[model samples]
Target: MSIIPSIFGGRRSSIFDPFSLDIWDPFREFPIPSSSDLSNETSALVNARVDWKETPEAHIFKADLPGIKKEELKVEVEDGNVLQIFGERNVEKEDKNDKWHRVERSSGRFTRRFRLPENAKMEEVKAAMENGVLTITVPKTEAKKTDVKSVEIKSLESYIQVLIDVLTAETRQNRVTPLVSVYEESCYRKISSEFL
Candidate 1:
């Protein structure tokens, strides 16, 4: 006979839900929490947020981790590319007489992974924690220079002409004209300055 009572099981929902806002409370005059606030709280409960920066020599990462001890944190590189930061925070035990109204602080294991760039030096990575913040440094490898040596050259025809002049001078001095074969001339024609 009553659809609303049957659907809701005769129990009113809190103002956190839009459908439950039908029954307003005069005592509850506080503003409703926004979606952004909920998201921020959720992120805070999960992995700590990090800031990444690239410098001339290295890549740096800074993560905010409040109320976490240095012994609980672990930083490592996996598969030569992934940088992993993992840690855990335990909830403090309450006394027998104390009552908790709300528990918003997160207490669990959290992990954050980042893909390192090609130039990052995985072997030389360093990490430090200070003032509730963890900082990681990944140095970059020095660039390699080409080892190829350059050679100078003139035109192919000019090179052949100089050879001919040398041969002519030798022939004149020796009174013997060394035979210049047609094959040699053909080979010289096919040769280019780039080869030299």
Candidate 2:
């Protein structure tokens, strides 16, 4: 009730507070969660939404998993290139004259992982689900093509005889100075007459 809602936030709910619905919900702490904190992680599958795509012969993944099944979902690859996906969800039997208002779906158990690449081909991976979407696929290998080499450029009097042999090896350690010994003897007779 002071310091301006503790320096600008969290203090505006009083029009005689009848469960004040002043509505500002900056992510109301993870969507409609409460019914004694209805578990299943407060809303599972919906957060399980995954996606990754890359074609040219495979490496796709998708997930949504509503009402999970296929024996309650699970897929794996582990270590030789990690890809695991997990599952679990069970939160519905709550009677006693069921009154609940809003408990935002989520029962429990969910995981996802991925790492595969090295032209993946993990024992021909594949999965499918449909109508709640799962679909996976990973097959790819055979990508190695590189070959380009070309070089040979030397002229301008062999770069003025390598800049007159690095200024006559740094002016022969501080002594040779008749205009750099006549520009290193006319750049060593024009690079020994352009290699004779």
Candidate 3:
């Protein structure tokens, strides 16, 4: 009446069981692996990771591509704001009699993109690869200085009206009557002098 197979139902004890390992064993030691220990094929399958830094003159981008050749990598900018990086990693050749015990290394194509800031100078961007690391530089455009200007008032009436509106708002919020009175007296004096 049982639907489960005999191999699946039996209680078994073996060295391969994951739960059998002793966590507190004093003689057991585990070593951490470094980036250099990984095969090129394994590292290429991962998406390109990058670091971005901004300076007064330019923006810099550094990407990790340990096993990729400069000829296989590409860098591009689109619509002035989008930055793209892509590349491919070829798989190693295998012999007819060789057997793969494990395949932790991955081989394929990968790409990464970023949206640049408004100040980036897309036209002057440059890219270079050294020691399997890609570095990109995008210069920033100089900021324009703002100019202050004085507008002339053609008529006294319009000038008085603008002053009154500003004073009204100021009086309502801060009860600043002295400023309004001073401005009103000065305007009246100027108008009277013009008429006389």
Candidate 4:
């Protein structure tokens, strides 16, 4: 009697061999997408990214931090110009242990720091955390001006004397003298203002 091949024992061939594919064609024809690109396509409920901007008067920082708690977050100044932010995220199964067949949520620590401009005022800095996001702002210090007062010249004599002194000093110091010399020539002069 001839025995027929058992259906279960029938030989089967794999559609594609992994080893053969690797050896035959090592280079991937299609480019792989990066984490940033993948995250951008997803909704905020799934992933979040950071965004920031700066203005002449202040610097603003904003970050998406959904599903996080105030107790898990911390903000501190590392130095005069460093702003640091750190936080931890923990996701546990709400139901009893066995009911959770899969855990896909991410859990870890997140941190970021910013190096502020020299004019930033640490004392005036402020931060707020709300709706799973954080925003921080630091104001810039006002610009300063020179302290010297203006000198009034009523007569051409006084003006010429002043101009000579200015030109002599400028030329001796290898600084620009054309401005002082022009003023001196336009106004008639007699004696050196310093000696007189």
The most accurate candidate by TM-score is 1
At residue 36, candidate 1 shows an lDDT of 62
lDDT by residue (80-132, candidate 3, tens digit) is 79999888877889999987655555568888888998999988989999997
**What pairs collide in candidate 4?**
none
Q: Please give the lDDT score at residue 15 for candidate 3.
A: 68
lDDT of 2 by residue, 11-89 (tens): 5567675454355666556656556566455455536878989899989999888777767888999988888888887
Residue-level lDDT of model 1, residues 150-177, one tens digit each, is 8768776787877766666767687544
Instruction: Give lDDT per model, in order.
Output: 0.78, 0.77, 0.76, 0.67
Show how many residue pairs clash in every candidate, following the order shown: 0, 5, 1, 0
Q: Rank the candidates by lDDT, best first.
A: 1, 2, 3, 4
Q: Poorest 10 consecutive residues of model 4 by lDDT? A: 19-28
- Clashing residue pairs found in predicted model 3: 42-106
**Strongest candidate by lDDT:** 1
The C-alpha TM-scores of every prediction are: 0.60, 0.27, 0.54, 0.50
TM-score leaderboard ranking: 1, 3, 4, 2
Clashing pairs in 2: 40-107, 40-108, 43-105, 43-106, 44-106
Name the candidate, 1 or 4, with the larger TM-score value: 1
Native-to-model Cα distance after best TM-score fit, residue 162 in candidate 1, in Å: 10
